[model samples]
Target: MSGLLGNHFITQIGILVNDIEKTSKAYSEFFGVPQPEAFLTDTLDKAQTEYNGEPSVARAKLAFFDMGSLQLELIEPDEHPSTWRNYLNEHGEGPHHIAFVIEGMKEKIELLDRKGFSLQQKGEYEGGRYAYIDTFKDLKVLVELLENDKK
Candidate 1:
């Protein structure tokens, strides 16, 4: 599994939270940093989100904090069948996924699929796209792949 993902550099950690406002505040107070603004995920037209191989309107409130070399992400999912919502329903609030910034999104997804790691949910953001792979059964945590547009 050494080269499963070209490199092992984790760029972000995502956590599912029932209350983004409260959680963000608590994290800010504890870390002595300002609470980051929370915003909803992009709409279907822009995000092109998919869940379980079907088009989905699942959205979430998100807040991000830059902590040293890694980013801490807080997610509060809407009442939709997304990876975020599913995990929260089954496991309550906790860590959801660890993400890596990678290139060759299509090839990486194909490689993971061949390795039995199915895609759970995927969507697009302003500058990039993200995919959540079903690696919990093996790795005990979901794996997210982020591929940003090259500038």
Candidate 2:
């Protein structure tokens, strides 16, 4: 296994919300930051999505707040069987996951697999790929792995 953890950096904090617009406004007001524009995941290309290791077309409304080096992400899940939706259904709306940006995604995924973390969900965007690892039982939060395209 590769030194995935050593090479990774926590870059984002993700939250699951029942309503994206309200949550975004709340967060913006609380943090004194401007409310971010919401984006729909289904509108993006290269959106290869999955839930619980099965192919899925789950979509979500997403908003992001830039907090210097880290970002705060708010996700409002549609009526779909996605990780976000499941979290919202089972645990209500709250902090869901923390994301790490890394270089070698496949190697890092293999390392996490060897360490017994199951991949709960995955998706690919135009120039990046992301995976959610089921670490809530141990860490009280899911872990997201992000790999951006190399320029």
Candidate 3:
């Protein structure tokens, strides 16, 4: 089914964790998949990260476990102020956001904004960009928007 963001396909489920090594190992063993190596996100200049409407230097170590059509992502954030760091601090380590892959990033963000969903943070990655929207009050989880560059 489709929603305000357009398509309803959930591409990823992000979790905040205190320890990436231990947690990723456990998940790997449980899922019978090789342990995915954790990698640091891009630096601030490359990532062009913004948090709470201001530029930020936040970064995180991330590991992804591909589960069929969806991915389970583990995030261990640094001390900087970011969506990952803030959520990890406030909620202590658990499910953080459910992400959807979309096409028009700017339009989707604007639509969500019109609906009163605040954009908490945004950043760029190697292949795509992401935005974290504060949809916790209604959905019990933040909603992430992933827009990959067309190859």
Top model number, lDDT? 1
- List lDDT for all candidates, in order: 0.95, 0.86, 0.94
Residue 40 displacement in candidate 3 (angstroms)? 0.1
Predicted candidate 2, C-alpha RMSD: 2.1
Model 1, span 4-86: residue lDDT tens:
78879999999999999999999999999989999999999999999999999999999999999999999999998999999
Mark the regions of model 2 whose C-alpha exceeds 4 Å error after superposition: 1-4, 43-45
- TM-score: the better of candidates 2 and 3: 3
Candidate 3 lDDT over residue span 35-74, tens digit each: 9999999998999999999999889999999999999999
**48-91 in candidate 2: lDDT tens per residue?**
78787778878999999999999999999999898999999999
Clashing pairs counted in every model: 0, 0, 0
Decide which is better by lDDT, 2 or 3: 3
- Candidate 1 wrongly placed segments (more than 4 Å): none
TM-score of each: 0.98, 0.92, 0.97
